[model samples]
Target: MRVSGLILPWAFLLATALFAVGLYWALWVAPPDFRQGDGARIMFVHVPAAALSIGVYAVMAAASVTALIWRHPVSDLTAKSCAPVGAAFTLIALITGSIWGKPMWGAWWVWDARLTAELILLFFYLGYMALWNAVEDQTTAARAAAILCCVGSVSALLSKYSVNFWNTLHQPASLSVDKAEHVHDAFYLPLLVMMGAFYAYFMAFLLLGVRKEIRARRIRNLRGALAREAGA
Candidate 1:
């Protein structure tokens, strides 16, 4: 916990630095795409948000699994906390994707496979959170919510592969092949920096969420003990 606490400040600072440098580079230093022109700048933020949206769901699902199978209260709290974060990231991805889509696809939205799957993924996040809130008993809610998370993981997978598996206006991943990013030399650095920033941002948020959930659980336990004492 102490290690994670120390990492938090570094993560936030790194994310801020990367974002500052990356955005400046993306906006000014990077040349316009021959095809997409300046509109491609959206990818800098949109791709990170989209990628992390899927990534966050995986975190939620895994934590959900541990919460259910092992009855780990911390896992349950972590899973529940991640829902809002994932939802927020998903919303960012959708809005930016839509902005990019308007000029490129000639429409603000389309029935493309990737787009459709991502939309469903967002719905899943919302549903998971709603389910958690609807239940009053924490144990029951955790179990029920975990089931939903595990089930909805299918949508997350579909979203990740929709671009490769089907015909879509959404372009293939730019960061393929690790060393060789299919983009121009200028765009690659900024894109990579943005990706790093996004990753750091995710880690920082995850730590915060875990810490918050842990504290909340502690408070609840204390209150429960107090109630028992008062009754005695």
Candidate 2:
């Protein structure tokens, strides 16, 4: 908590700075796509949000695995904290993708493979969080939620590979590890900056969320103890 308190402000500041630079670069500095024109600018927001939606779920799944196997004290909290954040990112990705899609695809949405997979991922996040609330015992809730998260890992995988596995309206990744020349410098650099800003924002939000979960757990424990004492 103490360490997070010190780092949170810096994380927020960094995210703010990067967002300002990234938006300016993406909106003004980068050339409008000959094909999409200014509409392409939406990718500046959509791409990062889409990436983080999957990335954050991956983090939650990893934490869930750790919590289930090792029973690490903070691992469950970390997974729980990631749920709403991941869901928010997924929602942003969906909305932005639809907005970008309208101009390109002639519709606000389609049942494309990648889009369907992403929607499923959002459902997984919702179900995982719902499982936590449905169970009364904290231990049971954590175990169930962890299992759900691990099982939901398949959705994340599908989301990443759906474009490759099937023909879809959604385009393949703009950047790639194997492909050196994916996008031009102007678009690539600003996209990178935006991704960094989103990551920094995630870190700040995650830290704050974990701290809140810890405090809530502590209060629950105290209340349980008080009830036991009263019963005795």
- Report the number of the highest-lDDT candidate: 2
Give a tens-digit lDDT track for model 2, residues 1-232: 8998999999999999999999889988999988888898999999999999999999999999999999999999999999999999999999999999998999999999999999999999999999999999999999999999999999999998998999888998987775574677778889999999999989989999999999999999999999999999
Residue by residue across 1-232, what tens digits does model 1's lDDT show? 6887898899899889988988898888888989999999998989888988999999999999898888876898888878888998899999999999999989999888888999999999999999988998877988999999999999999999988898888888777675664777677778889989887787778888888877877898999999999999
Residue pairs in collision within model 2: none
What are the candidates' C-alpha RMSDs?
1.6, 1.2
lDDT of each candidate versus the true structure? 0.88, 0.94
Off by over 4 Å in 2: 179-181
> How high is each candidate's TM-score?
0.93, 0.96
RMSD of model 2 against the true structure:
1.2
Stretches of candidate 1 exceeding 4 Å from the true structure: 178-181
